[model samples]
Target: MSSSFQANLDEDYIPQNILLTGGAGFIGSHVAILLAKKYPHYNIVVYDKLDYCSCLDNLDEISRLKNFKFVKGDISSPDLVSYVMAEEHIDTIMHFAAQTHVDNSFGNSFNFTQSNIMGTHVLLEAAKCHRGMRRFIHVSTDEVYGEGETFETEAMNEEHVLEPTNPYAATKAGAEFLVKSYHRSFKLPCVITRGNNVYGPHQFPEKLIPKFTNQLLRGRPVTLHGDGSNTRNFLYVEDVARAFEVILHKAKPGMILNIGGANEVSNLEVAKKLITILGKEDQMDELISFVPDRKFNDLRYTINSGKLHQLGWKEEMSWEEGLKTTVEWFTKYSGRFGNIEDALVAHPRIGFAPGSSVSNEH
Candidate 1:
């Protein structure tokens, strides 16, 4: 990139005050910390609804930062969103607020629709109207592409068909359409990012890595779905956060980027690896439980992230390093899940928490 071109990009991308929705959630919190520490000049307002899954503990690392402020508000409420944008003088919006659990979406889809679809609509409407709004980067998931049929040749690219099989994914797809529509009809400065499975510290306990780590810590059997042949690409949470920063600064309006991991492994392999990491390889036979498969489980998910790579973003953590760090966090901070008596209060489950009652689920 030339000096003149870089200057022009910087002119278009520099944000004064940024509204980071869902800053208390897993991925959001990680992104929030990165932004807060990396760019001290920018005011970072964390807007979160503080649902059961959204924990203030996630933001503890950056709570004392002078530029960081937490605002308790629902993104679904147009009035509240508008008020915050105007009051905070938000120039950039990184929207990560949504109900993101696939299993929960099956039972209580209304909450997902209200939070994911309706909430995005409300934010987009507000963004288009905000006179000072410079950019809106909508955070999304790779599940919206449904499933990958073949991992033999090519990976799913940005232009892949939007075929979400589950309710949660469906709502995200709907939200993405709303974003695209706003960019077309109103010419809102918008960018979209779809990330693969993200795992790291501060992730809710209900997710695969944390849940399994917690289960192993408690000497419980690891639950295996069906034959456990389902494969997924796992990216470290921090890498995904860095991708958001890259997209925010470098991506143009109407651009959709897919952020994925190079490390792909089967679900069964992940469980076995965790067992080995815990030094419980001998207990594999006794510590494994093969259960019925989830309804409409996708066999595999793979996405080509050449676009993001070409834009000068590379993952810093390897799979081994990321997983080891995650396991250590779960072992050290097991109390984040709360006690048995306060299980329901700690994690409000729609259908059920994956392994335990206290699910810091997404």
Candidate 2:
């Protein structure tokens, strides 16, 4: 918006050295591996605090690549982030590090605020001061838009107002405010993307899909919040990774796009589907247990992803294919994070300090 703009929107964005925060986590790791392997000439630096939900094993595919490097640190640490920026000569930043569990956020809203809002501020400040910074791609969630009316008719777009319904979503909205301010004031090139629920391999079982699959695999009751009428558009993790890859090269500065998915399913439907996929359809009635809902559970979250589709990114994984692959992966590798019994429960109100992570989790 100003003459001091750091990037030229007219030209293709070229990132020689990139920083991917939370790159060891589920979705972030997929993006990290894809970028590291796809862009051989680009240096991919992963900076993460290795929180309870993340594992270094997620990045094994790219660990041996010469262009890939890993750094363990918190984004809220100004000194460490600055050090990495200087050492890596980072020109682009894809911010994905944040405390993302809604249930956990209820018990630990302060941690969510610190990691999602304050930590994002620290990265924004670092990017602003770095002269080589060309672009800042912020990875956000569809929850920021709160609950949508319906997938068939009431899908929200990038222009919709943000009304986050939970502590986790609220903190994400707070971070978006800071990103927008940096873009308008300092002209630090920034683009934001709000993505749907992601399900695939390596996802911690705290979320719905993987959690249900694992519960069924272990012969435990699949837990559902409330009557299970809540609906969410599910995108396979790799499809989401491809969306980022598209945005990384094609998105213009100051643009905000919604990466919605076509596979919209209700919580009840998902639980039943997982049961059938896991060969427990006979016990579907007994395996699914309704639990108390969250402090506030949005009924549905549907967003219009036409903008991202226009950028050459579209959902490729069918629901049948994605769900089957996810169930199979966890059936064999359910111990990826060791015993995940804690994460299989309906609601785990995890308690952790602001800007700090716990050593143990589900």
Candidate 3:
């Protein structure tokens, strides 16, 4: 498939049954809804494990759509995956279900390996067996590139070497290799997408943006890790979803693409901006504190999405605009966020060990 054809899929030119593995999660849910709304004729099935981070509420708007279907299952369950693929006549598989939290991965590296790496193997096997399956798009992250000096220079491209610093990123990088190997050795049609830090509505409070928003709204201090110098490129969830849509139709077998907002910000700067946006500038001094950083924390991650851009796609949202909108949404839905006490209790920063336990507070 050429990028031109993929770009036109939005017009319902190439109709195919699509399977979204983590359709109930933040980015997946948004992508599912976009497909349902734009290509109403195509079948859109959501296969999710309904993990704590995934909420059905995220799919509330599209659940009633005629072309939408929801299946509660784990990607690691080959039997379930095979059953769904056969029954749904799935042609394209969007693999997004995995243990995503870096901090959580530290504490339980086994879970990360099982879900991110092993689960992908199961999915690849199923895709290979399914008769009509044409493409498998593996959603990945920029962290796979690990710490680098290129963050401030040209964005890291597909040619960058894989050096995942955390268990979560390592698992994702492993999954990418598996996909590439399957495509090369077995001739499985697959494309890998490395996206930047995504934030927006429906995101679990464990992530940085949402967590900080929730804490500030509740008058709690937002913890900053290691002097807040670590920088990350933030992309809105919707933009990331759109990139998937673009790649699903356009990318050829064995292709890898990078997607990012092209905007980078440090943790300290982000916290200060959020505090100002929320009109709590006076509390900034007390609300932000630098704690020990994660183990082997990658000081920077930035992706050069020139490949995707050359394919005729670019991020449509800016961080400043995206952040304000995100803050507004979290504030509007403050009631739904509930309390962060449990999240804090479940994963504490005590012992100050990096790479020891994956922090739920992304």
- Once fitted onto the true fold, the runs of candidate 3 whose alpha carbons sit more than 4 angstroms away are 1-15, 150-154, 335-339, 344-362
- Best model per TM-score: 2
Select the stronger candidate by lDDT from 1 and 2.
2
Q: For model 2, how big is the CA root-mean-square deviation?
A: 3.4
- lDDT, model 3, position 198: 88
Query: What's the true lDDT of residue 106 in model 1?
Result: 74
Residue range 182-220, candidate 1, lDDT tens digits: 988898888888889888887776567777777788888
Q: Clash pairs of candidate 2?
A: none
**Candidates 1 and 2, the one with greater TM-score:** 2
lDDT pick, better of 1 and 3 = 1
Sort the predicted structures by TM-score, highest score first.
Answer: 2, 1, 3
- Give the per-residue lDDT digits (tens) of candidate 3, residues 1-362: 12122333334225389989878888888889999999898899999887767778889998899999999888888899999999999999888887777766677678778888888999999999899888888888888888776555566788888888888899888988899888888888888888888899888777788878887887878878788888887888888878877787667767788887777889889989999999988877998977777776677877778778766677888788999999999888765635555443224444422221111112
Q: Report the Cα lDDT for candidate 1.
A: 0.80
Give the candidate number with the greatest lDDT: 2
Candidates 2 and 3 compared: the better one by lDDT is: 2
